[model samples]
Target: MEPRGVVLVAAGGMDGRGAMSVLYIYPGKMRGNGLDLVARQHLQALSEAGVKVECLARGAVSMPGITCRFLRHTPANALSFLPAAYYYGAQSRFFGAWACRLLDPGRHRLVVAFEGAAGRVFRRARASGVATALICPMGHVGASGSRAELAWPAIGEERLEEEYAAADRILVRSRRAAETFIQRGVREERMVVVPGGVDEEAFHPAQVRTPGPFRLLFCGRLSERKGIRQVVAAWKEAALSPEQAELWLAGSEPNEMKAWLDAACGAGVVRLGFVNDVASVMRQCDAQILLSEAEGMPKSLVEGACSGLATITTSEAGFPVQDGVTGWTVRREDSGGTARVIRQMADDVEAVRRMGASARQEALRHYTWAAFRKAFREGLLPLRQSAD
Candidate 1:
């Protein structure tokens, strides 16, 4: 049976579009191999679901079912801005402005905008009798402009408000994220929770970690927001020699923390900036940690769980990792608490391994890409069709 409606997805990055007559618009260059593999995975999944996706990217994506539409002008960092918060909002707005020129609103029955980037596109889609869905797809948006600025730099208060007011439904990835939006005055009814998922084929447990030092990984950008400094502090407090325990830091190092990071690196911490093989890193490590101040079900945590590695995290880091079952969640910002947890793991390798196996099972049962796609596709259906 055919699905009810055709949708248009406008994202500054690769987001989602439905099956059959669905068009996906991207603001930047897309390659077969690049940093944005998550976006590529999404595109591939939608195509496999039989969506006729007209993809707007700079380069070629080798997907068999997708139709590539090369934008004459790629999304550029050609503008200057202040407070660093307006830069992304401005760029996203520009992308929508340029993209709207190419859109024929007569075609789509539904439209989805990602991270306030497609407010203009949503407006146009709504004008053509299409329902609009807005999604920030982040940890949280604060009541104050500065808080939103701190959380999502590319989306400013104005653009965020525009998106909030324009759409029929607002898609959030977690309950915490929905709460944040509600606090900002958006009704609970308008918010729909659709968490992100991992591609199991790429991230499933492929190899058992070899016997070595008690290895722990810290992925994602090395920034204060991700609790990099807190992890470093707790690791130092764990008081284990290099032979007994070691920490590996992946992703880009923050410029502001270079001095601290350099000193830590000299003390035997390995720094791998922007690792390409995240799954390999996860599979090889005994554990991982993400003690973020704010988060919306991080993909790294899911990947780690899928790779059969117990993740040491915090409640604020959100994503249902069962404490003492799949993994452990320490007190937020408590270096002592984190250190104690790490110390216990260091002593009992068997317990860590057991938790890792359980983590993989739980993730496999709940956090698959298939589930993400099913939820997203259902959201595309009209209210009547959905109720039916």
Candidate 2:
């Protein structure tokens, strides 16, 4: 993991006499499968690469060699009554302003930051002549679809544009994400497609599904934009009974969709609700499905694939499924196709098992955390020399 060019130093050791030191700002907790996980992975990559790192985040994550500064906690439910977008935008702006004050060009060679909260940091870093890399985990803000399609809100495309204009490099999660940015006038050379990764050990291939009903798993927030309603529609079309099959959903159930999902629960839809160890749940299931309308490369898809579950996803969801080999890539609007795939898995268990095996092999080869670390180190650390 030591990618050459950066050095880890002690506290207050910034005599402006180091190899390359970085100030990483995420502005969110370092725990979920969303951007939080992305931030944690980047920090891990930077640390393993022997890069000097200082992290600013909403929640504290203790890593042996990195300096982590936890910001004052502001729970999202604090503003539960308002629209989700406002709370996220306000949080990003607040964190960005706070993080901007901590930037000392003499100490930090490069500032690695996430979008929505990097505008001020980028501006400050540029003014101070420090290098800047913006991590756009969710990709282009202007991409068409519901705002909730990605993990976070767009955070105002204009604000993101300001950040983009100042960033020396923009790191995205997938080729599709990079394409969206290119379509929106972002120079291809300035953007790096650093796709997401899976923890191979934690999400390893399942040896066998738990005995009983053939289960279909959906892991994410229960929302309309996530195509939950469509999932239910497809399940209805398949018309499997509890004895024959079951649909397992693992995520927070929002109030808006609670009533609808509650009704579905009676008809073989089991809500495991907010699971922490997703691997355990995936191990018990026969297959996974996510028909998202838009995404930057969902970790769930990679995790599922790594867990040896054939996926039913959309091209827009950004995981390159090998069509009948690894999984089925369905249209966002094609519930019938999804239903057919579901029926296929139930009717042909051996075929589903073969698909899952292929998926795990593909994931292990391309989407492991080690691979992500390599890509991150290679794509961004060279800026260290320029900064030096």
* Among all candidates shown, the one with the greatest TM-score: 2
Candidate 2 lDDT by residue in tens digits, 266-291: 67888899999899989998889888
TM-score against native, each model:
0.81, 0.86
lDDT of 2 at 59: 66
lDDT of residue 345 for candidate 2: 88
Over 4 Å off, model 1: 1-23, 32-35, 41-68, 75-77, 80-90, 102-105, 143-154, 206-208, 264-268, 383-388
Backbone clashes (count) for model 2: 0
Query: Which residue pairs does candidate 2 place in steric collision?
Result: none
What do the candidate models score in CA lDDT, each in turn?
A: 0.69, 0.79
lDDT by residue (50-119, candidate 1, tens digit) is 5555555444465645655554343334444444455555556655665466555444445555665677
lDDT of 2 at 185: 86
CA displacement after TM-score superposition, residue 251 of candidate 2 (Å): 1.9
Candidate no. 1 TM-score: 0.81
Q: Top lDDT: which candidate number?
A: 2
